[model samples]
Target chain A: MRTAAAIAALSALLAVFPFLATAPWVMTIALFTLMYAALASAWNLVGGYAGYPSLGHAAFFGLGAYTEALWFNHHGIGAGLTPFAVLPLVGLAVAAAGLPVAWIAMRTRADVFAIVTITLLFVAQTLAYNLRGITHGAQGVAMPVPDFAPATFERPFYYAMLALLVLALLLSHAVLRSRLGLALLAIRADEDKARGVGVPVGTAKLGAFALSVGITGMAGGVWAYYLSFIYPQFAVDPLVTVAMVLMVFLGGRGTLWGPVLGAFIVAPAQQYLAYQYGASQLYLLGYAALLVLVMLVLPRGVLPTLGDRYRSRQRRARTLRADVGTGVSADTGGDIAADVAGEQP
Target chain B: MSAPLLEVRGLARRFGGVAALDDCSLTVRRSTVTGLIGPNGSGKTTLFNVVTGYLRADAGQILLEGRRVARPDPARLYRRGLCRTFQQPRVFADLSVLENLLIASGRRRAALAGPRVRADDRDRAEALLAEFSLAGLADDPAEELSYGQRKLLEFAALLMSSPSLVLLDEPTAGVNPTMVRTMERHIRARHAAGTAFLVVEHDMNLVMRLCDPVVVMAGGRVIAQGPPGDVQADPLVLDAYLGG
Candidate 1:
């Protein structure tokens, strides 16, 4: 009930923020934040939980964007809200495409898996550059501008992206709480042991990979439709995958809200830095500095650290209770003091 | 007494020029605690790995319940009711102890759908935790456990699967006496309940006390196999232990 209330309040705040902001740039930043939050959460499913750092998500993202772009172009959905309708199907198609890739990539592990996925990004970028007939080469695909008034232009996209974020969050929560979640967590700890214990390691990981990329593709479709124009450069950027990874690492990996918090923190800083120093590309300097800072300070990331501390305190209390039952002495005045202090809510 | 639960026939596995397991044949009868004891470099661990499907055998066949297993994928073998614990206990360190138990599959046969943890699984996990004296740490992550505790946790997890043949690798090697006692009690209890165990331990005392039809390996081959008293008195066994 408490979680439900928190979620309801957060949703309400997100839904109402655009109306009050009014500025075009603010709404743009807001939309991008939501998009990154959703993308990072999706990435967390496989990368964080299964301990598979999939750098190939950028390719899936590009495919989703291009699929939507090509669909809109072919159907001639002229600058209207109709492109939003097929986002789910776009997600499914890209997820299906992800299976064969997962089948191959998941065979190797750790650095090898990363290597395979990195190859995917380059291969995808090369294809996008060379596939002139479908992707229109490097010229880019342009969507007809939406016919909405300037006052209400970003609202639809913002709301759409918010819905995607909510969907991603809910899915992350569900997966974490289920048996698949247990399997993924086990795989993350020790893949060999996970298999030895009958985890169905391959199938569980594949399912997570598919779900992760599927959600990412949906986000890409929405992002493409919102941006109104996408070239290979921006659509399939490897840096995009890095950004999501950074968000997850910054907030906390494998925790539900970590990616969301990381995305919320990162996307705005990125947008603001780009807005300020994008021409010089000096914003990258700040990003690199921030990356170092994150590593130095929160190596395990935020949620896990805080969670460990909280659970440690809980463990202490429970152990104390068990000790009391076993007729063990408190040992010290400080120990009793600390126990009482920790026991308080 | 009954049929052989696990039969590894003339199994040979090599690494480069070294043959870790050379024509090692062994049979673990149903409902028996069969100990595989040898020196540090003996092929006991290698044989365990090969039979449990962690490593492929160079030549030979393994039959579980009369059906020959061609490919020994660990998960597949586990669903076929074979489970193994490592020398260094491999508990899910990040998960709660209860979760560690819950994560191990409880079914002997493969299910069409995912085997989500059932209510009975929870009940059994709790019962096992109390039995193992780990009830106080059920909500704690396994990483917080002591080395002996981790070994106990690993044994509890293997028990969760209701394994037909459990291959235990040095289950009580470094554990304290109390923990070792708890482990032996559980092993005996489980064996009495009709589960078979193939244990690899360095402790001669434990092997003699707990195992019947003990199999001793030396230089990657089974040099001796018989009842505990018979194997203990064998000249080859004496040579393997004291000379080689």
Candidate 2:
């Protein structure tokens, strides 16, 4: 109930944020915040729940951006419902591209899986650079400008990204409660045991990969249109994947709201650094150092740490409530039945 | 009663130069708590792994209810009603105890459960928890439970699927005496309900008490077999335990 209420409150805040911030810079920051939040939520599905650290998610994001760009330019669909309509197609096509990659990467465990998945990012980067005719090489591609007034141009894209985040959160929540979620969680806990217990580990991993990258690709499409342009470097940047991973790590892994919270915390700091430093590399170094320091302090991440504190407080209360004599060690968080080894017949 | 519930014929598995299972053959008759016992280096665990589809045999035939299973795949075998436990009690430590039972609702691929947790599953998990006397810990994470409780949780988890044959590896090892009795009682109750168990345990007393027609293995082959009294008296069984 508490989690549901929190999600509802945060969602309402994001939904109403546009009207409160009329300044372009504020809206731009909000847009980036929503975009990264959506991206982080998408990454959480695979990395957080399934415990598959995919370093190549940027490849899918870049693919989505390029797909949306190509579709927009080819059809001359300038800032309309049709462009928004193509996002699903963009998501599916990129998700299909992720299938073979998932099939290969899911075969390995932990570090090897990371190594295999990171390779996809580099490959996609190479393709984007070398595909001169299709990607326009280093020159980058341009998105059709929206016909909406300049003052109001960012609203639609902002709402689009917001909608994407909500859907991604919904999907993540749905998976978390389902048997599919249970299987993924079991696989994350112990893969061999997961298989022995009748979890279809292979299928669960693949399905999650598809769903995660599919959302990421759609986010990429919205980002491309919002920016009205995309170069290979920005589209296929490794830092994008790093940011998503870090956000999830900061908030909490395998948690629904953790990534969103991380995004709200990290994206603004990142945008601020870019705003103040103006391309100076010092802040980037500082950013990395600060993030590492935070993670080292909160190894389990923010949400879980808070949950632990809450549980400890709960335990303290339980301890205080225990009466005189007839001593009951209610310490195992009220799981007293587990203490009944000799008591059972 | 004459028909074999499970049969492993001439199964051979090798780890480099060591043959873990050398022409191993055994039959678990219907409705029997069949015991597989051996010394440490013998093939008790190896046979259990191969038969449960955790490891592939070099050459063998595995027949469950008179039908041949081609290859070793744990999920597929589990759907065929062959559930197995480990030498150590391995539960999903982070999941709730009730969830550990709910996650094993897999007579088929559990991924096919789609996007919703069925209400019936929750009811079944509650019922199983109550039956195991773990209803109080249903909301607690499995990690918080003691080792003995974890073994009980694992046992209850496998029961959720209502498997015909449960291949247990060292179920009583490292557990307390009271917990051991509790496990024995549960196994007997389940056996009475028509479930067969293939228990790989090192406790001779447990084997003597729980199993019928115990099969003894030495150096990767069946050395002696019969009722516990006869097997205990067999010179070959005595020699394998004492000499090897």
What i-RMS does every model get? 3.1, 1.9
Candidate 2 per-residue lDDT, tens place, B129-198, comes to 9988999999999999999999999998988787899998989999999999999999999999999998
Which candidate number maximizes lDDT? 1
Over A99-176, each residue of candidate 1 has an lDDT whose tens digit, in order, gives 999998999999999899989998998899899999987998988778888987899999999999999998887787
In the order shown, the candidates' Cα RMSDs to the true structure are 3.1, 5.4
DockQ of 1: 0.46
| CAPRI band for model 1 | acceptable
Clashing pairs in 1: none
Worst lDDT 10-window in candidate 2 chain A? A336-345
Over A109-165, each residue of candidate 2 has an lDDT whose tens digit, in order, gives 889988887898998999999999999979999987778778877899899999899
Worst 10 residues of 2 chain B by lDDT: B107-116
